[model samples]
Target: MWMNEKIKASEVELTGLNGEDIGIVPTREALAMARKLKVDLVCTSLMSSPPPCRLVAAADAKKEAQAAKAKSSDRVVKVKEIRLTPNIEEHDLDTKKQQAARILQAGNAVMLVVRVQGKEGAAAKVLLEDLVRELKEWGRAKTGIQVSGKQAAVQIDPVA
Candidate 1:
């Protein structure tokens, strides 16, 4: 993120004000060019032998960063967790299903976790699979039932 005179490279790979490549030039020359164009000589890449720098206005750079941040924020995907027991009653299962439906409709995924102990392990797997089937209209199972020693889990993603 070196800017202007702070750029220590003897020669930098420069880009012009309108983003055209200006090839490699001495740091001093690049700084002079930036001053002539009334823009910042911003070092964009440091990994190369000659660091790459771009000419950009401070306001334009700030705006570009803000736009990228907003774009990334807009893509944030949320996953809601719903916990259940192997022996969940019918009414409770319906309520949990409804909650998952709401979360899916809101563009979020749902993770169903069914806790079990010993003999209840198989039941937990079945419960997870059954719930996935019932939720097919709202979301599809992104992952099949994964049964660990004491629990089974599945992720349901919203239908696109």
Candidate 2:
């Protein structure tokens, strides 16, 4: 990204503002040419014998980089977790379902976890299966119900 006087090389393989090859030239001459065009002399590749340089407007490069950053940020996906118990009441389950639906509509994945304690361990698996079936319209299960210690969990992703 060395530009203008910041470039330490004495010579470079230059490309014009319009991307036309200008061949190898002294760094001072390249700087003068860039000055004439009101652009920057940026060192693009330093691996060659004569480092490759390009004449480009600094403002344009900055704008392009900002646009790319914004584009990448917009495509970020988040995973949201909703925890429940096997003996959760009907009203609470409905509330959780609504929250999961909202998260799915916003383009996020959901991890459903049913925490089991003592005698509740066996029934938690059945509860998780029923929960998956209930939410089938909003999302598809990415993983089958799995038991890890005292927790039964499944991951679901929003339907495309």
Candidate 3:
């Protein structure tokens, strides 16, 4: 059956095995060529006027399309967090940084939050900046690290 959209009145456009155009061949001819190539005739791209179709192996076309979908999905973002105190211990900071690194390496954004205790809140930025800088080194270029306002925070997501 012909497509509902208007097309230049002709036999039919068919693409060959190597993706070459074998323009306006009879439908039967196109089918025969597909069988000769041991492939199926597939419509590959949109053509407003002609609605171009291609003759490719059915299995190969499906696999290629699926792979494309998976590749795109892999880029989807995920978020993770890490928390610290303004007066955090040096060793504990190292441990926390390592944990954040692991999260970022696994393809997630890390939000680093620093909580200030008592008088530590006023001087929190000094420590928070240090901690953010150190944690950022773990992610390198793969993750984005941001510090939320007010140093008295208790949350940092790894998948920033």
Candidate 4:
């Protein structure tokens, strides 16, 4: 309700695009007004004893938030998964390792998983350990064991 910004409240206030305060009105009245203006009733302060809510146009409000998030944003780090095996061929392992490294360099986290097949499942622990060690070394630039399980996982953050 940027068009109507006379609302105000100390215990609660109206939040508009870019965290702007439009003003505060009664909960029911504010929401009704927001709906009339085709806006959203968003809570800006949830920790306040009574919490504060804001009336903002859903589309415009979201756009502002997205813009804010994009500004000085960390490259949206996504999880890139790579499956491995203990008896994996050298060439295959190296190829996967390189792929994972590339993902890390691109600013995405990498999740490496080692699956143990029948018969080989007995040695799955040793296999996972070795693979994890290799990946940790190669990904030392940005690496951490995020999860270790029957099907283990390793996370590598951006190199920078």
lDDT of each: 0.89, 0.87, 0.59, 0.61
Taking the tens digit of each residue's C-alpha lDDT, what string does model 1 give over 1-160? Answer: 5678888999999998787998999999999998897888888778997999999997886776677678877866699999999999999999999999999999999999998888998999889889999899989999888998878899999997
Question: What is candidate 3's lDDT per residue for 1-160, written digit by digit as tens?
Answer: 1221222333457777676777766555666676787776655444543446567676876786687778877766566656777777888978977877787767676666676555666566666556556655444333333334554432333433
Candidate 1 regions off by >4 Å? Answer: 1-74
Q: Which one is best on TM-score?
A: 1
Each candidate: RMSD: 7.7, 7.7, 8.9, 11.0
Q: Using lDDT, give the best candidate's number.
A: 1
The worst-scoring run of ten residues by lDDT in candidate 4 lies at: 1-10
Which runs in model 4 stand beyond 4 Å of their true positions?
1-71, 118-150
Q: How far is candidate 2 from the true structure (C-alpha RMSD, Å)?
A: 7.7
Indicate the TM-score of model 4.
Answer: 0.44
Off by over 4 Å in 2: 1-74
Can you tell me which runs of candidate 3 are displaced by over 4 Å? 1-73, 117-122, 140-160
